[model samples]
Target chain A: MNELLERGPEIPAGTWDHDWISSVVAKAEEYSGRPSHWNGKLYEQPGDVAGVCLPDGSMTISRKHVLDQARPAYTPGETLTSDQQFAAAEATRMAVFQARHSMSEVGDDSLPGATPLESLEDIALENARCDQFSREYSGRIAESMTDQSLPLVAQAPLFPAYSAATDRLLYTLGGPTGLSHRRLGELIDSTERTQRLNAIADEALDHEVGELVPESHRAELREHLTGPLRRGLGGLTMTEMSELTHPGSKHSWGWDSAEWTEVEFSTNLGDIKAHYESWEAEHPGEEPPELPDSLRETFRDREEEIQQVWASKGWPAQQPVVGREQAYYERLPDHGPVTARDQEIAKLQQFLWSHTAPSQHTDSAVDTGGRPDNVRQIGSARKHGRGVE
Target chain B: MDAYREVQRLYAEAMMSAASGDELVAELGETVQRIGDLLPQTAPGERASVLLMNSSLAERLARLPKETR
Candidate 1:
């Protein structure tokens, strides 16, 4: 009967039969005796036997009431009336158990039995393999998305196992010939390594240029260079500025003037100075005007020459020189004495004023230093002038 | 051991039987057809067959020629 039931389909619902329920209830009764409240209390109701609760609202009981009320043959499988359903469900459950056991025995030769720990280990290993596969697959997918060739170093993590997989793939797909896979891989790896090093060097340079350079020097260098350096300055120090500014120093750094001249039209100071000196030397015969003191001496000599010439020519002269005397006055470096010229002009004006009106003696003769008699006669005439008047 | 060998043999067979095509639409149809062939509804179980179908499809796709894929 077990074989027959086991071979049939599994029961689809859960229910039980009345006979099974009654038998289970009888077993329960046999074990516990008549239903009663297990707890002992002093105020007991008339119909409350030990622990069992009566169906009427008047009686109270213990947990025995709940247990007694349960139908015992409730199993899981078929749906039907209690008696028929319980039988079918019980049969189905027994059939399922037997079927599992028989099938296990039949397949025992093929199945590998493992302890729980061994099963866990196997699962862990499988999970690891799956993770590795997933990682490789994802890496490949990422690599394929771009057409541009990645630097060999950047491509390393994407193809962890093989060194030249990318290059090999490229070569296989009608790439340049005369390129071995190993050589190509090495080339790419070296190229990418170089690129990475260069990038690192660039970043370091930026930091040095931006932060390490002193503010004053940086501003000066900026003005000198006119802009940022295109080729890096190779970590030059401030002390190198002396070498940089020297006339023919190899260490001197600057833009190529010849190259930049087309854009910058201003004449350089060096060129201007050179041209000025060359012009002066070319016209050596032409001298700049003499210093102011030398000019004053020359003017005085010219004045004497003019006076002698005027006397020899008998040109009517307005004033005669009493004496010729050299004059000296201290002056600032660029300007001559202001007070001395003012004093000289005042003396001339006073002399003119004294000579303009004749005294009471009406003598027209000029004062030549040789004429003392003439001066005496004029004096006498002045004394006798009142009587004649 | 026999069940393991059978599983491996069936997997390899399914992988070998997968179709190849030049067009994406054709390849997709071939993939579906191969999966359906490897996983018939009449099989006693569904889980193992479904797994086998998926794995076989993946293997076939991987082995496909670049131009065809």
Candidate 2:
């Protein structure tokens, strides 16, 4: 383990799986030892031959490479009983889940596509690689340095740009560097994350009460959810979005503390509606019974149970709502107040009007000071020295 | 509205109502010669503005959003 994985989120109490952690760390360390050129390619296994470099400059690892690696045999810990081991295994599973959840938060969709254990291993690999790259880069800088500034660091591993000299020259000229690799990468990453988070938040909300929506209205409802509803949720962090949509979340309050309550009530109503709708679907011609007070009371009791969970969890019963409302409306860094698309639409809309409007052909004299004072004076007797009209 | 005016109205409505470039394309059906098809033949003077309109629309449509995973 590299510093990054060592500094990763701590395992919750009693959930630590030492063997699982060791395996992940070993895999990552092994990965880090491999040549940087083999970063994404499959490694040579026991039966595999050396990778052959082809004419077009791509290396073929194996023609008959298996899609998944064989799992190693597990060695149980001596001190722990089966039950304790099971608990540890469960904890390991949750850790992997948390890793996948983190990938989703960062909008690294490809990372989550792999098997759960592979996902954890991949994260470990990423952290190890980052650590390795930074160390190698630091060494390169030390080796190449003659002056205070690093003019030769472009040749270093993961420097992002190839022209450190150009950057240095521009810096000396007191001008901004034309190359903006880090900033551009950050911008692109943040934009992707925003869009993914928006979609996830929208889908979570839909799942929360989607049963209530009529089948006929499903398509329209989808559009609304993905469009304006997604836009509304775009400001929230993924965790906040998750809490808002999750029925069992104790601290569901986002910027608005009461929003969770509203969602909870609506969810209860949605359940009742869903039950009635299901019954109606079952018996096509029968008139459904009026919703009972008992059902409402039952859900209301469930709501109280949720409140008790909140209390037991030691979360504040009510969140501080006043200060955060304005913060809720603040746009994500990637999504500005006004976008290039909006400006384009406004421009094109104006162009459409300008071309189509009949009045546009005959220039309005408004810009020419509304047909000159002399022309206006000609209509009145003022030019001929008449006293008043 | 006249056919040409109606075309202009629909185009304007599409531009205004579209939340995205994809939506705009869907609203306005694929017309390769939009300028020739929609620009009023009678009004030669407005041809430049109509051309500008189509080109601007094309510029906007070209700004495709990055595909989400």
Best candidate per lDDT, number?
Answer: 2
Candidate 2 Cα misplacement greater than 4 A, ranges: A1-214, A222-232, A237-258, A261-283, A286-389, B1-69
Q: Write the per-residue lDDT of candidate 1 for residues A129-187, one digit (tens) a residue.
A: 22222233322321232222212122111111111222222243122223354443223
- Local distance difference test values of all predictions, in order: 0.25, 0.29
lDDT of 2 by residue, B1-69 (tens): 243333333433333332334444443333314434655452432332233233323322332343310
> Which candidate leads the pack in DockQ?
2
Instruction: Assess candidate 2 and give its lDDT.
Output: 0.29
Q: Over the stretch B1-69, how does candidate 1's per-residue lDDT look in tens digits?
A: 223223323332332222335443254434434443443332322222233223223323433444554
Docking class of 2: incorrect
